[model samples]
Every structure is written in structure tokens, then in C-alpha cells.
Target: MKKLITALSVFAFLGFAGAAHAAEASGRIAMADPGTSTLTLEDGTTFEVVEGVPLDGLAPGTEVTVSYEEQDGKNVATSIAPAQ
Candidate 1:
């Protein structure tokens, strides 16, 4: 029973740690470099987009909401969409 409790505690902590790495931001794009799969916001936050994430119609001055996770000290975008 003690081992089971310890395992559950570890799993819970791991889940929260993973959740903390995910985040969202909304801002106007300062630049969109499809060649590099990178997007920079006017506020200077940069995100590296993962493959299969569309960058269509994204350009300077376009407002967007980005969902990303911090991976290897870089913001890796999981999704990108126009701001409502």
C-alpha cells in the first residue's frame, strides 16, 4: 500500500509538471518565417512551430493565439490560429 501511494504521488507530480509547460498567448505577429517554422510576436516572444501546424495566411500584423509548450528551452507551438 505504501508503494502504491508513492507511485501515485509521483504520477501526480509528473502530470502537473507537464501541464505547467503548456501555455497560450495572443498577440500580433511581428514576423512569420515559414522557412524556419518560426513565429515572432510583436511583443518579442518567439515560438517554433511543430510540423503539421499550419502557417497559412499568417503575416506581419496578423493577430493570433498560439498554444505551445516549453521544450528544450524553446517555445514549441502545438497549434496556431487567428484570434477571434
Candidate 2:
């Protein structure tokens, strides 16, 4: 019983560690380039939209929240949504 509890605790800790590496930003779109599949925030932070993460219908001046992860020294957006 104790061993099982310890294993579960370790798995939970690992999950949290993965989540810690992710980040979120909410702001208006400063620029969006469909040709490049990239976008920039109003604050000048740039993000590369990951494969399967939809950016359709979004345009400059649209407010959105992006969930991203840092990879290759760049922010890669995992998901994006209109800001509520």
C-alpha cells in the first residue's frame, strides 16, 4: 500500500513538472502571418503556432490567450483561443 502511494505521488509530481514548463499569455495580436504560421503579441512576444493548433479567423487586433511551451529558444503555441 505504501509503495503504491509513493508511485502515485511520483507520477503526480512529474505531471506538475511538465505543466510548470508551459506558460500562458493573454493580449491582442500585434501581427499575424498566415504564410509563416506565426504571430506576435502586443507586447512584442512572438509565438510559433504548433501543428494542429488553429489560428484561422484570427487577425491583428484580436484578443487571444495562448498556451505555449518554450522550445528551441522560441515560444511554440500549443493552443490558442479568443479571450473571454
Candidate 3:
């Protein structure tokens, strides 16, 4: 019963952890440094580009929407697309 309770606790924690990062942002790119895989938005938000998200189209003044999560106290983008 103790093992079962521990397993349930872990699962519950995982479920709620995902909800904490369910957020998105839309703004123009203020700075994009491919060397560091980092971007700064016009609103003064800084984010690190996650693997598999293309950066070729990102440039200063480009409008974009970003799906991101706060991991290790840093904003890491999961997806990026042109703002419609």
C-alpha cells in the first residue's frame, strides 16, 4: 500500500506540473542569437529556443507566437510560429 501511494503521488505531481507551463506569448522578435539559441521579444521577454523549433525565419522585428515553459527558472520555447 505504501508503494502504491508513492506511485500515485508521483503521477499526481506530473499531471499538475504540466499545467504550470501551459502558456503562450505573441510579440515581435527584438533579438535572436542563433549562437546561444536565445531570443528576446519586443516586450522584454527572453527565451531559449528548444530543439526542433526552426530559427531560420526568426529575426528582429518579426512577429511570432511562442509556446514555452519555465524550466530551471528559464523560459524555454517549445514551438514558434509567425503571428497571424
Q: Candidate 2 — which residues are off by over 4 angstroms?
A: 1-20
Estimate the overall C-alpha local distance difference test score of candidate 3: 0.88
* Best by the TM-score measure: 1
User: Is 1 or 2 the stronger prediction by lDDT?
Assistant: 1
lDDT at 42, model 3: 95
For candidate 3, which ten residues in a row score worst on lDDT? 15-24
Residue 64 shift from truth in candidate 1, angstroms: 0.5
Per-residue alpha-carbon lDDT of candidate 3 for residues 1-84, written as tens digits (9 for 90 to 100):
999999999999999877656479999999988778888899999999987777776779999999998888889998888999
Q: Against the unseen true structure, what C-alpha lDDT does each candidate score? A: 0.92, 0.89, 0.88
TM-score of each: 0.79, 0.72, 0.76
lDDT of 2 by residue, 1-84 (tens): 999999999999999778638899999998877778898999999999977876678888999999989886889998889999
Residues forming the 10-long window of minimal summed lDDT in candidate 2: 14-23
User: In terms of TM-score, which candidate is stronger, 1 or 3?
Assistant: 1
Candidate 1 residue-wise lDDT, 2-62, digit = tens? 9999999999999878774679999999998888999999999999999999877798999
Clash pairs of candidate 3? none
Q: What stretches of model 1 exceed 4 Å from their correct place? A: 1-20
Error of 2 at 34 (Å): 1.9
RMSD of 3: 2.8
